[model samples]
Target: MRNDEVLVKVEGVSKKFCKSLKRSLWYGAGDISRSVLGLKNPEKLRKDEFWAVKDVSFEVRRGECLGLIGHNGAGKSTLLKMLNGLIRPDEGRIEMKGKVGALIELGAGFNPVLTGRENVYNNGAVLGFSKAEIDRKFDEIVAFAEMEEFIDTPVQNYSSGMKVRLGFAVASQMEPDVLIIDEVLAVGDLGFKIKCFNEIYRLIENAAVILVSHSMPQVAQVCRTGLVLKQGKINFGPGKVSNAIINYFGIFENNGLNIEGNRRGEIRNFKFGNNDTSVELDISKNQNQPEIILENCQNVFFETSVIIEPSVENFSLIISITDIDQKVVAQVTPPERMFTNLTKMMVVEAKVNSLMLNTGNYSISVHIYNKSNAVDRGEILIGIRNILKFTVKKQKFVGAAPILYESRWKEC
Candidate 1:
């Protein structure tokens, strides 16, 4: 098929499962009997049955990669299994054009007793390759997996990472017209994961790819379009990957301010804002964490007052910014000299000029540390994680970087 051709198409597909295993077996037998008798099975949910994937529809062209993202148990894997033909949807139709390669689960198609070399050929044959074709691609697959020395080992003996490397190598090297990858890549080491992403980029040039992952960065890096599933239904997209990522993060509620440290200090008041906006907190109400919205390149300022015990002599204030994954993206630390004078009560403030974070949700963490103890050591007098949350909005979604630096450009 041509590059623009639609290789995978789904129309309102839905799948349901029974919660009880015994009931599930009974229902399966009844469905089989009805099928043999040429009677249509019921479409509605029965007792203890629930839809795993509901009314999902989308199409993938030959040169496109669709990022399917969601929280755990959001039916992402169920939809992928349906698309890969491992299972059938109960309610809709699916059309897949050409050879479909999948690494949906670790060691999914391999026989544990078989050697890696034997399983490679077995998988190639399952993908409709003949002996000659498998022979031509065999060496390349082994080298890509870096399993040349372990090719003769049984797959059961291979580590999880080894299985992931071998499985990804076979699925990608075959050059199938459609590739479906689940979260199996998370098992491999970072180096191999990078190699897999590079291969995925090359594959999507002429093939239709469907990637299901919880890693938003991975989805943003490789996918042109995205779909977010929530509770077996579409929560967002068949739209921009960035918006889908934002919607995915929106599924979880933000945590309240969590303070941890020695009792030497207590935060009395905290507030923050940008040049165009400011937020004041009322700690007496015991309210949920406050959220602030800011435009791109806005200046951010934060101020807090802390009451220290008499024994505490000097302390330094540290502010850290974290993304939705709770990964620290940016941090601000003042010079130690700023806190030399001893005081029982003090107000500290910090400012960030022209904040350049990408469009996403971020949280602030405040730390008060004794100046004499090293920052690396556990010398925190007081610390609050998720003390405040903020979102940066932009007109257009740029590439997924924690910081979108405004670099000066010139032609030489």
Candidate 2:
């Protein structure tokens, strides 16, 4: 809470894990034995052990947010656990300057048998607040979580989304000097996510935060500094999280095209273009780019060019719009088209009339399906996830199901 404090400092940190569960347990026993005996080479890896995090280091000062991003098993979760003190780094040092609040795993510290309200108080107390202090902020936390009706329910009966809401509510409202949140934001609905983000923005005024999310836009929205971990090493340094995002997505080799893997066709190019307007998207950039902002209630033009070889006969384009939280907004695509040509370039276009989505960034995935002659069924050939992305803004807070449906006044 002091001015210009260094809330978290990680130095040459590394952690290792065993591939097999039984070996992992054995490794843990060996580690404890070595520690008790003050043995040397304790950090050395065993035959079954692999480095989850290796020589990674970073510092977060007051009023700063650090972003951690990588593919699954790239040591993101391991680094977060080390930062939260849930797991110790096999080597190097981690220093915490003040009270730390971490929302690491989903419902990590909650007592399943206790009621949600009771868990709130318990968490608040653990964060160093008195009973009277928790009492003063309890209503605000419950209201922010929108769990007023279910606050008294046992956590065992609560859904995963409910647990996320309550966990985020308590952590964000606890006023910790250091805040660390993993990918828990994906569980809550859009409304709660927006509220949670607002709270994070407010909390960073005098605190330091570390956030990890697969969605680049979400990380760019909250954090100014970033790190890209690749195979247990820090591939990118802090500062300019946008560049870090490009680097993370750029890891998709072969020009970001999935042509070889079990597929009936190849996506030559995917872009957003409107013939009537000058709004043309260069597909070479990262998905959900900053240059593709569009106004709501306007037509969204999408074009995907595909090439199918002789083996596969018929195919169609199935495009899906997914928001930053990885929620499927709509499977908006062009009318069905059956093409029988082989090694021919075919362009598929979709015109979404009056885009009803609320203000946020969305990614478009191009999925090609082929009707297999052997099975007489439509099988997914090639799926290019998050091929393109765009931002939408200048809208009020609306409920889920972003599209606006056609309506007319009728007598009931």
Candidate 3:
């Protein structure tokens, strides 16, 4: 790698955690263990040795955003801690090019007993800032944190949001060469999250960023590259943001979505995909529809699979489409939407009169139910299947909302 090309680099890093009871003891390890073991009902000895991270290595260039995604206990947090220099890796080396600002946990660098002002200065110093420099950015930090009135109050009196706000404000001002953030951003209100994203976007223009978030949309929006960690190693990485997400969800399907013993309804199968990339459809923008020739669009169709649960009675299917704002855009009616008194496989179909959506994104929502009241209804209590999302785009804007396609532009 060239000198100016990389801002942060890690070569073959690994971290492990011990689950031993005696290992955690200081001096009287045997005595404590024997005492506990000799009790009337001795506690079971659980095996130790869990590898949180194994041989993980990747480099991040300056002004690049990297997303770290993994299942719970996938070493994402441990890797982040090592990057922040809070913990040392058991193996391999990490090289950083410049100062780092990290928001690993809420209230990480705060002094509970000290006033907010003091904590700000303390955190600034921890980030290697001088008193004068902290003072210069003090007002901006306080304003951004929205804690001016309580600037003199001790941190112990602050709420979680306040703590996160202060921490984010201070870190935002550090202007470090790299920033490492965990999923704590999911806390706080929606507006705060939006503000944080804006600030982080600005920071990414000058610094390398490593974001660990559970929200897939946030990860896709900010990071150009991502690594999907499975068990303890990097399972996928250096891939397109969308592909990384698909791969990450693949882990869940393999593990999280596995059926346990048995539930009310048994799910047969499912499918997921993007209908079109050119349209870029989401809930807020356009319904996920392909460009229609208006005349040829007598029927614009979306596809989804139908699953029948075991012994479900009077079962039926439901399909719906909602805008990016989650408002219902369209839905297949029951007579045209449902399957009755049948098993095996059912195909769901929806027809649209015309596709007049503006160039935007939209989502498709589907549901399955039992029509107990109807005599011909197939009653089966299978769990609701996954949502199907697609995108629709065009060269020009057609209508204000999806359904308002045939409006006039007369100046009369």
Candidate 4:
């Protein structure tokens, strides 16, 4: 229980992979043959061999959580395996102290033929827990997993979700010195995911937890220290989780705004920032869709900058939010907020205190219109058709409607 205790330490650890199956088998055979003869190959490259993780290093201390983030083949999984001792590093060393509980892969260590209840006891025994200890914790794991009906079923018969639930339940119950969870939690339902999050947080007071995830917000929430990997290289060192997240986003410089039509005004920028972090379109530009939160802890606001040309008027500002399928989730038109006359150039902004939308990406279109006219079908002064987007990431009330907080969205 000393403050200087380091739970997990990975220093200069690296793993290599072969591009061709034939090369991999040949390399394995050569290495095994050399080991039997007490001989070592001096040549480093054996054709098609490349480092999946090269010279990566980090430390996770007790009571601290570390986030590992990157793209699909960023070596995060390989590093996790090294931490769990499932694979040995091609070079360097990994020092891990105390009992480690890892939910690395779905149903990784469980026997397919054994019943869930039997596996629970067997795995606990493998983890150095006595029979009596497993007996005492068996029911709690089952109840937390909500898998009492299938507790007696064979492990092979359980679905992915069921296996993940059972795995997390077991890991969470066991107070290990280190808890490592890869992308396995992404398969579970929303409620279970939230529950597991809370459980992991509680464990943070005593154990060091390592989380590998592709979701930025999830990593930002759980970990204080961050490690970013890209193509087997250390891109960003362990630092503030927030800054690491932005670095991991790989967005630099102002990628021009998406706009269309020769409208009355030139929409220069549509950006958002708050007291904590500011994502300006001029600097860090998001992808096709951005996200918004309603009165969340972070003070977030959206500002629209535009330059009006000459004298253009009698057009209403129409803003519409639609889903991917082009269905109008919410539509609002501020009646009589029309700019009847413009002197030279201007910037107009419509700010919302807070909003609550569904988790999916919602496309936003800003348009200037003058009520339906007989001469023309489209009265768009300037139409940025689905040019920008926002996301509502909070998943809640899954079985019911997605549209909550009706008051936030002014119904047409």
Candidate 5:
């Protein structure tokens, strides 16, 4: 086959399931009878039935990878199962060319009673490999999985990580024409995951790859294209991976404020923005977190009023900016000397000369820490997470870095 050949083509594919097992069995029997009588099954959903995947269409060519991403039960697994030929689509056609390898579930193809060594050969044979072919790659698979010691042990006794290691090693080593990997890699240790990704990078150069992961970074790193599923339908992109990730984050936005800290202090009011735009957060009136939208490198400011207990003397205010994944991307803290005076109620203000975050969704976390010394931010008097969210619009450079620094270039 040519390198640019389309290895996987899914056209208007959809799958549905009945909510009740009895209903599902009944539906299955009826469908089977209809098929035997040269009749077509109903395309529309019947009672107690819902679409798991609906009218999804995309094609993957050799030397390309497609990232399928969504929240749990968004039909990602059902779509993958259909692609792997483990299940049939109810409403659409799927065409896959050449050999296909899938690691859809943890230890999916593994035999519980069989030793790791035996299962390796069994999987290889299932992939159309002969005994001698499996023997040639046997040691490499063991080494890659780092399961040399446990190769003779029954798979049923293996840990989750061990099973994942062996399963990935076999699937990847066989070098099938089309490879489908689900989130099973999450079970492996960090070091092993890194090795597996390196192997995947190599594999995608010659094979069509379909990756399903909730980890946006992993999907961005591996897939050239992406598709986001929401409630059994396409929410965004069979296009750029970045946009798909953005849409995926957008789906879960407006999650209300989360606060964690001692009861010594309470935030009365909070607001942030510049002259052109501003957002005030009202916990009483609005249950959803408010969002601030700004262009890259814009100046922004924050102000908050807090009421403290009589026992509170010296304290420092901490502002943290976190990404969609709730990972701290930036933090701001006032100097210790700034809190010299003691007061029961106070208003605090902070300014950012230039906000350099890349285009993405982010949230602010406000923390009031007790300050005893110059170095120690002793303990949290009050901490409010997801106080409000924000988004930095796309700029000239759309790299993955959380913070985008402006740099000047000189050509020699």
Candidate 6:
């Protein structure tokens, strides 16, 4: 591969599908008639056609790992298929700079009847590996997959995890010019998933990779640039991974795609408390303290945005804090605080001063409500929940709650 040339160039790619099987039948008939007439059907005749992918174009340079992210059926898989040559675009072209090895599906090229050893060679040969090359890398593939004992076993008998491991091992070992993987890491155990992630990162450092995953954290850690896919097209990306994640979720949330169309807004990037030790006041140390008192209730709340139903208007999220006994300690209404209409994620601080309580183990409950009352969501106590817990030590205080104030006696 040249040092400065683009590895893959996708230009004006679009894929369309007929809505129903009946429409597809008509499409076939139209194609036959057009072929016989040495002409094509009028573009208006295919107006009923739905575009699964629309006018998508991008160029991937050599040695760049690009992330493709979207909800299910968002054309991400279709785009990958086009790039892998498994499917052709209805309009436009994809130019590859080198041999493309795509693990588009687990056991995609493996023969069920063939032994693991045979399938490896079969796939390797198809991937343009020489016989000697396959032989040299055969043991390494088995070792990396940790499937040495199953080498002679027919691939059909291997478990799904084993198949994934072997497929990844074989594909990575062959050193393809470009590797396109589609959510393969979503499967497998945690240990194997971590191993796969590390291996993919290593591959990115040396070559180009297109990673597709449902986990945002995984993508944020792996890719520097990402493409967000909307309904059936590559929407927007090439920005921060967090933005990509928010965009990916926004597509569904805006479309009323949640279960039963509950139409609840999303909670993004929630950090429970401050990291400093001083900020994390542990009142638990004072068993002598009669009541569980939260020293600093100021630093607790789930911060996010709220989108109302039907209108989908954005509202600043409101949070209310309660004691383990379901006592409403403090309520922070964003609208009342002059923070009503929020177009994006905004930071809000909730504080409860002078929390009086009888010293005992207590829990915290959280309630989230929209400004319009269209959505009211709260976390119910299953057993004992942890939001904030602090103990009050018995001291020379007059009030039932712990409070300190300077007092002086003067002659009248």
Pitting candidate 1 against candidate 5, the one with the higher TM-score is 1
Q: Encode model 2's per-residue lDDT on 120-204: one tens digit a residue.
A: 9999988889999999999989998889999999999999999999999898887888999999889889888998899999999
List model 5 lDDT by residue over 1-412, tens digit each. Answer: 6889999999999999999999999999999999999999997789999999999999999999999999999999999999988899999899999888899999898999999999999999998889999999999999998999999999999999999999999989988999999998998999999999999999998999999998988998899999999999999879999888888988986655577888688888888888778988865465666567887445689898887777877777989999877789998768657473356558899988887888888888999877746667778888888888887787566777998887899999
Q: What is the per-residue lDDT of model 3 for residues 111-173, given as tens digits with 9 covering 90 to 100? A: 899999999999888888999999999999999989999999999999999888888888887
lDDT of each: 0.88, 0.80, 0.70, 0.75, 0.88, 0.64
lDDT for each residue of candidate 4 in 12-40, tens digit (9 for 90 to 100): 88888789999899888888899799997
C-alpha displacement of 316 in model 6, angstroms? 23
Candidate 2's displacement at residue 65, Å, is 1.1
Model 1 residue pairs with clashes: none
Worst 10 residues of 3 by lDDT: 253-262
Predicted structure 3, TM vs. truth: 0.69
Q: What's each prediction's TM-score?
A: 0.89, 0.66, 0.69, 0.71, 0.87, 0.62
User: lDDT per residue, candidate 1, 290-318, as tens digits?
Assistant: 66888745677889888877786777788
Error of 5 at 289 (Å): 6.0
Model 6 stretches astray by more than 4 angstroms? 1-4, 19-48, 254-412
For model 2, give the 10-residue run with minimal summed lDDT: 273-282
Instruction: Identify the candidate with maximal TM-score.
Output: 1
Instruction: Output the worst ten-in-a-row residue range by lDDT, candidate 1.
Output: 370-379
lDDT score at residue 163, model 1, on the 0-100 scale: 96
3 versus 6: better TM-score goes to: 3
Report residue 65 deviation for candidate 3 (angstroms). Answer: 0.8
Question: Candidate 4: where are CA atoms >4 Å away?
Answer: 41-43, 251-412
Deviation (Å) of 393 in candidate 2: 22
Local lDDT at 36 for model 1 = 100
